[model samples]
Target: MATPLTAPTTDPGCRVLGLRERKKQRTRDALVDAAHRLFLTQGYGRTTVDEIAASVDVSQRTFFRYFANKEEVALAVMSDAEDYFIDCLRRRPADENPLQAMRAAITEAWLELGQDDQSGPAGVTAALELFELLETTPTLLAAHLRRTTEQEGVVAGVLAEREGLDAAVDLRPRLLAAVFGAVVRLSHLSWTSDTAAHAAGPDGMIALIERHFDQLGPALAGSWR
Candidate 1:
């Protein structure tokens, strides 16, 4: 967990000299930005923690202050999306069914992402490339999978609370969360492989996900060969 940022303070004969919280945030962001650039260009396996810290003119100790390892830095980019989805899920209306709520939450999350300036111009192309990096790199893939598992548990607990079920005792909440996660992973694999899909970019990925959600009914209820 991140240490809570301290509020600026002042007292008689005392002064808050600078924006300590903002400076820490900037350093953390710079480390992530530099790491992503190196990981994208030189590849994750080739990049070293020292190089990441040096790129930001910070010490190895400073880098460790922000992230435990290179894998943590690599996943920080994706963590924003994860956080957005969970926040949206928590805010969805009580009347909506589980699947409907998931869909609506993701839609809102993506809409907010579209308006946000943070993604910037290394662009969606860089983001997709990073996804490809995760898919192909063993160490990164393992880390990604671990994060995915942790997020699934979070989603399941959220679902249980919203539906008034005991998450520990009832299986429905976990089952739905598992299915939703599987669909997301499957959609990613399908979207990444279709060479013809490159031109569509982020929108194409979203469309693929929507199509997968559309099939969830038949996928769960109908027979398969």
Candidate 2:
């Protein structure tokens, strides 16, 4: 089943105070942060939305404004990485094969992710912190899997758009996207195992992803075709 996305709420209740989409994003961020910390403390399934709502200093309704359920939000909250991932996909050179382009782009992009918040994106430590929190908790595991699966549809769409009504265009792009997400997630889990080692930023990650491409590059062949 397609996971339901909650419509952005428009209500400006005392606690909410604005248009649904803006309110939704803020509330989502707040609730996710709260749940993240709480999961680290109380365990994932044990941390109730009510508790998350309480910690974020918002009421139940305010929490609902952003997430349909604690599971969906908690599971999906850390997914801000997709934007960077998409950017990497876009960075492929015009002359490069789609797969090779994606590989190079991802390698370079991951290096960018290693930069400190001062460099503007979530730094090495932050990425590991989020990954660590997710790794240790089985409750959030299913949610993580679900979120990863959801990313395939997104990748598929990106791939489909690149092809201009070509009858022979294969489903390779969607398959490639799935494989790419899996590889990236695997690489992330590996690097984050001792994030401090990669704290200097992209150099280590570029090396790691380059190695991943050595093994997995074929999966992305003709993906953007």
lDDT of each: 0.75, 0.60
**For model 1, where is the 10-residue window of minimal lDDT?**
1-10
Largest TM-score belongs to which candidate?
A: 1
- Model number with the top lDDT: 1
Error of 1 at 172 (Å): 0.7
Model 1 pairs in collision: none
What stretches of model 1 exceed 4 Å from their correct place? 1-18, 117-125
Candidate 2's displacement at residue 195, Å, is 6.1
Clash count for each candidate, listed in order shown: 0, 2
Prediction 1 global C-alpha lDDT: 0.75
Cα lDDT tens digits, model 2, 1-225, are 111122133221214345655655656656766776676667666878899899878998988877788766665534655555666666555666556766776665555544423221123344445566678767567678887788777666665555432323676777777777787777767666645546744465566666777777455464644
Model 2 CA deviation exceeding 4 Å by range: 1-24, 87-93, 104-124, 163-169, 194-207, 217-225
